[model samples]
Target: MSTTVTQQPQHSTLGECKRWLRVSLYTIFLLTGQCTATLLGRFYFDKGGKSKWIATSVQSAGFPILIPLLFYSSKSTNHDSSKIKRKRSVMFTLYLGFGLMMIAMDFLYSCGLSYLPLSTFALVCATQLAFNGVATYFLNSQKFTALTLNAIVVLTMSVILIALNTESEDSKDLPKEKLLIGFFCALAASATFALHHSLLQLYFVKVAETGAFSALVRLNFYPMFIATVGGVVGLLGSGDWRSMGKEMKEFEYGRVSYVMTLVWTAATWQIACIGMLGLIFEVSSLFSVVVGNLELTIAPILGVFVFHDKIYGVKIVAFLLAIWGFLSYIYQHYLDDRMANQDKSDDGLQVSKGEEQI
Candidate 1:
């Protein structure tokens, strides 16, 4: 006679529930930070603001945000196994490469934003999702199942629709040449953003053995430190530093208010990144993108109020298409979760069968 001993499953308590709660909150925070940066930048640029160097300062804000994480990472003790993992996972050169790529992505996206209106720029930036999908597949060998394909196609179509809407809306006001320039720069920015993020995802999945939050710290503090320095160099190259204070003082809001906006925007930017890193840590990059895209909905709505953006019928249609694509992607995530649960159940059943035979 064989006695089968069944193991009790681990109970998910309030802590686990709170983890998801935090994820949702973090998503909101990320979106808010992005909106803050975009709007404040618009405010500055719209009113005779001409400091590309400020863009350099904004991204490097990640340097200071990593301060707490530095302490956190230092506290983590690696075991022998983890040490081996680190040896296999980390390459200093790779981190440096990521930072360099970031310099291009940051500078290009800033150029796009500087030229295009907020709503139009946001619409153009949506293409990054499609770029990220392609990059993830190539870089991480992430599979594209039918559901993924459906969502991606929908998103692609939505972006096309948004571009059409942009053409019809305010392209007349902006110089045709500058509009084209913004479009191309935004596209390039999307591409670089995709490559940088995909590489980071690879780094985390393959090499980083630390906990999510710890890895988050390292991602910002390490690659971002170099990226920030590169930005400073880029700023210096542009010869914008000497006139930065002059530009700040001349801002319509007064120097104190302008300085305050930068500080506030920088703080929001850091919080937003923390939220993004948190989501990427808790979930996945694709999921983080979905959460990030939710900003598209928010930014335009806020743009109406802040930038006095006029939303026409074509934009409405584009907005609807965006919602459709987002829903499709979200449904895909649900399908993935269900399939994962089914696999676990099948494994449990197989184990039970073996126990019965014993």
Candidate 2:
């Protein structure tokens, strides 16, 4: 009797599968923490807590925990730093510019949160993806497709609808002038963030290829500089120097347990979420689009449940449209992947036949 033989597909290693599982878990948790920190930072101002205190306290405490992890990861990578030597003045200038922009953006954004609802803030911030997409295409020569345009439009609509319908439960009077100023600030922040991403893609990637520490330092030096400067300026400019000093002193010594707890959550999420997404991208080529769409879809869902932000009819419809647009992009990608795999298999088969004949 003749028996038919079938090829079993090559599966990813158990360790690889486990790694991806861990990444997924980390991603979900990190996203939750990120969204929570963002909402907390925004809501605090509404409740009479100072925005400066919230931003500084949360970020300062949150970053220290992740520093060790980042250091450890940097050490583990075998990349060497000698190849990335740049003139000290050039590096300093780059970071100085970067830092100033970061400080300005953060100050503006944090100030905006004082007036904007959590949902409204998130929706406006969501425009970053669209901005990034356009910027990437022009700066990096990344190709634009119909799906990309559709995704951008859908995301923009989602943000606009959410912003227009935003309600204030307390009905407290808002300083409209300040609020408008804050909105422009947020818009400026978004533009800066987009520009920063493009610059990193151009320069930071090259530095990272030499050493992770160099990359991290290069990436963060400007932001940290910006934050420190802004925080100091904010503290000094608030008029109650004594109270600001006292709060900062208490913050340094860890007197604020509740705030510290929140900071822990933020730090853990920041490192783990970013690390996991990086790992996912390393493992799968299409991880970029997956991560982008996931963020756009999940963040608003989080806002709805965690903040008691309502998803009205227009928002619901807009969100559905966004999802549909993402699905279309994914489907096209699937076809592309299938075709690539088929071509690879054909090449392998031809190589095997040539070897057999020889």
lDDT of each: 0.71, 0.54
For model 2 the TM-score comes to 0.70
lDDT of 2 by residue, 1-358 (tens): 0111113113323444565575565455545555555555544433334545346534433444546655775677674355335455666677677667656666666666656655556566666666667676676565556775665666566666555665443233577786676677677767676666565555543334544343553345345644566666666677544564355444433446435544664464355335433422332212233344345455556667866766668667656766676566555655655675567656666666677688
Error of 2 at 286 (Å): 12
Winning model by lDDT = 1
lDDT of 1 by residue, 219-283 (tens): 76767778878888877888888887888768887888877776776777777777777776666
Which lDDT value does model 2 have at 343? 72
lDDT of 1: 0.71
Q: What is the clash count of model 2?
A: 1
Misplaced by over 4 Å in model 1 are: 1-22, 76-91, 115-123, 156-163, 166-182, 313-317
**Residue pairs with clashing backbones, model 1:** 89-207
Please give each candidate's TM-score: 0.84, 0.70
